[model samples]
Target: MNKKFYFKSYKTKVTINGETITVSRKGFFNLVLLRLRTQVINLNNIQNVKLKEATNFKRGYLKFVVTKGLKHRNVTVIFNVFENEIAVEMKNYIQTINNK
Candidate 1:
């Protein structure tokens, strides 16, 4: 995996696809503490969640931010696929610590 982006702490929670992905001081810190490194490629502008080469997990992790029947910021939870599920392979590219 390649390092490409960084996440900043938000004061409030953001909703994505009906699911409230919290980014609070406590919860968000935990996700970062795990040191997950993966780029969140926002494909909302394309108006489609399915990509041309989405099924190809062997290449890399791919997530689509769906916002069809929602009312907040769209998001996609992506992770490296292994065997038959999304694999949590991060830490190599990103470092987690106190956001201060």
Candidate 2:
């Protein structure tokens, strides 16, 4: 059996307390990730925001992770334009392990 690898790009929306956040576009994952990192650590004083990873053709791949106050959540997803589909994997353990 051949193992299948998944990597997709898509926009992510995050809403908290009835507020909507906008995710960035493709080829801007690094910038977004750095911003989120700062927000999580309270360095930038960002209370809420959306982080997104987009793949621009053969250029490269991106990953995103966002953290807030006492709550931790990760949106693991893959998007394929060729197949017109989005795949997601949720790893709840990330938050639990980091809490220690």
Candidate 3:
């Protein structure tokens, strides 16, 4: 799967329909950490995606609330996108996913 983009620490690898996003955090003592915590959101399962924008430089963050309804809990992802270019692209791409 080709990586469409990177949102802060998360790498988004998109296929034809859905995408797998992965984020890895370092363990204690600078040890290498495995990626056991990856968020997989099927585009078909996504009910809604809401965005929250930051106002200032100190608070420039991109937030997405993916609602899957009652069957599954909602997922909230926050990315520190210092610039708006990538943020807008990601938002639009996600919107497109919803439309499909």
Candidate 4:
């Protein structure tokens, strides 16, 4: 059995759910404003992972491609984290998921 882990920011989180990574937005009001977007991608579905460092007042993004031929990406975006520990944890978690 594995534990569910959350790499969280002010507005969003990338959570580990068994063999899948669930990207979701926090706060109910924001959901109403942003139109409620959530994405779940299996570790096996992932082909690549990229992290872009965030600047002041900007959120960093953790992007992974599930399908090679997809038109757009649906990834996890977190605020107040550029080169942070949570990012490192998420990256390590991805590697673990890949190894399994």
Q: Judge candidate 1 against the unseen true structure and give its global Cα lDDT, from 0 to 1.
A: 0.28
lDDT by residue (50-73, candidate 3, tens digit) is 566545543344444445566754
Task: Sort the predicted structures by lDDT, highest score first.
Answer: 4, 3, 2, 1
> TM-score: which candidate is best?
4
TM-score-based ranking = 4, 3, 1, 2
TM-score of 1: 0.22
lDDT of candidate 1 over 1-100, digit per residue (tens): 2222212222222222222222222245445764433323222332333222224444333233445455433333332223112112222111121111
lDDT score, candidate 2: 0.32
Task: Give me candidate 4's TM-score against the actual structure.
Answer: 0.68
Q: TM-scores of all models?
A: 0.22, 0.21, 0.55, 0.68
lDDT of 2 by residue, 5-84 (tens): 23334333321221222332343563466333111222122333232333455322223344566765543333444422
Clashes of each: 1, 1, 0, 0
Question: Where in model 3 is the C-alpha error above 4 Å?
Answer: 1-3, 9-36, 57-69
Candidate 2 RMSD computed on C-alpha atoms after optimal superposition onto the true structure? 12.4
- In model 1, state the lDDT of residue 58: 43
- Against the unseen true structure, what C-alpha lDDT does each candidate score? 0.28, 0.32, 0.49, 0.66
User: RMSD of candidate 3 to the true fold?
Assistant: 5.1
Which pairs clash in the backbone of model 3? none
